[model samples]
Target: MKRVVALAALAAALANSARADSATSQDLSKGYAKFSEQGGQALYANVCQACHMADGKGAAGAGRYPSLVADPKLEVSGYAVALVVNGQGAMPPVGRMMDDAQVAAVVNYVRTHFGNRFTDAVTKDDVKAARP
Candidate 1:
């Protein structure tokens, strides 16, 4: 009886440990996916190029379009979703970019691919939190 109890306890402990590990793995995967840079690039080309132009190089004359790619602030601790959703200076607010998930995807794309080494990917929650 004593041996049986000990074996049962050991099995239960192992099962609990495996469950905890599975949960941890899932959490990590979700966290990593939030920063998919390719998705961010797609968002940029489709939505941002009209103003900023290709390669994130803003127009010279009138300079109406602000540079979107390869920004110094790309390496900043916070996600750029706030500024993307909210207009700054002459940039207009995001109306079509209202889709939070799409915005995060695009932001991650730009931040990762545009000559910037930043690996951080924005999440839908991040965009939602900073939404105006």
Candidate 2:
């Protein structure tokens, strides 16, 4: 009877852990949608800050987040839109969590800010079309 009770307790603990993980993931995803109207800064903080870092310099380790500052990829608005919408490598697909306008705002902000001088402006239509 003790063995059976111990097994049940272990199973319960595992289930709770899984639930917590799922909730954390959902909260992170929701952060992308938070303050969609507030434009790039808010969106970046809520969604990208965890991985890309607040400075946009990204991290250097086993899996790099790729610095957004002065990145050649930002030279093309479409490229940035596609990356945000479809994601790449270790990056998760965040387009679905954000509306087209939000995507455009964040993409444009990233391209223009972070020591970047890219003049191209990403439109909502561009983000919508880039969705995979």
Candidate 3:
């Protein structure tokens, strides 16, 4: 009986561990942690840099990721917001995994970085409006 009880406890522990791992995997699969608390720069490095590159110049060869550096497309905040939220060809709608605040943060970060000097900020409200 003790052996059976020990086996049951071990099984329960394994099940709990599996549940935790599954949750972590789901969060990563969604482009990043759901509404992750990380700041814009961190988010960019963790998520966007894989495709867009660390310098934001983007990459090619395997795929054609556009350069964000001094791109005129970022002049308008709304356009960037929409693209991030809805995505364009090749780029997935990564913003779907982010909340409005997270979306705005990463957008604002990109707009301000990579040779971009756009002063205007993308508010969370703008992100919300851009969704769907």
Candidate 4:
């Protein structure tokens, strides 16, 4: 009887730990959903690939193509959203082609898919705030 009770207790503890871990992961992102990530990927495919290349290596010498992945403030969607909207160097202002939601999606995509540390996904409001 003692052994059975001990085993049950251990199992309960393990289950609780697993649930806590899941909650922690979702909470870490502050309610950012996986669906938003997909939107971000679509935006990147549509708007960014031409010059920066699909992998974001960019071209040599000319530097007309900027590195969209792992760039200045790449880990933060807010900073990236600002640059995408305002434009910099050779990058044309993307706000002309995309709205706030689209901008957030792209920024979130690059920041997350490129292995950067943007924990929470970007939102339309984030893009609006980043606007110059």
TM-scores of the models, in the given order?
A: 0.61, 0.70, 0.73, 0.62
lDDT (Cα, tens digit) per residue for candidate 4, span 1-132:
999999999988986776578675653212222222236766676567766778976777744566656665686566677778888777888654677777877777787765466668878887777777
* lDDT string, candidate 1, 1-132, tens digits: 999999999988996786578675652222222322235555576567767767876676755565656688877624477667776777766523347787777677667765766777667888778776
**C-alpha RMSD of each candidate structure in angstroms:** 13.1, 10.6, 8.5, 14.9
**After best superposition, candidate 4 residue 118: deviation in angstroms?**
1.5
lDDT at 88 for candidate 1?
A: 71
Can you write out model 3's per-residue Cα lDDT over 85-112, one digit (the tens) per residue?
8988978888887889888999899999
- Model-by-model lDDT, in order? 0.64, 0.79, 0.84, 0.68
> What order do you get sorting by lDDT, best first?
3, 2, 4, 1
Model 3: lDDT to the true structure: 0.84
* Stronger candidate by TM-score (1 vs 3): 3
Rank all candidate structures by their TM-score, best first, as comma-separated numbers: 3, 2, 4, 1
lDDT of 3 at 46: 76
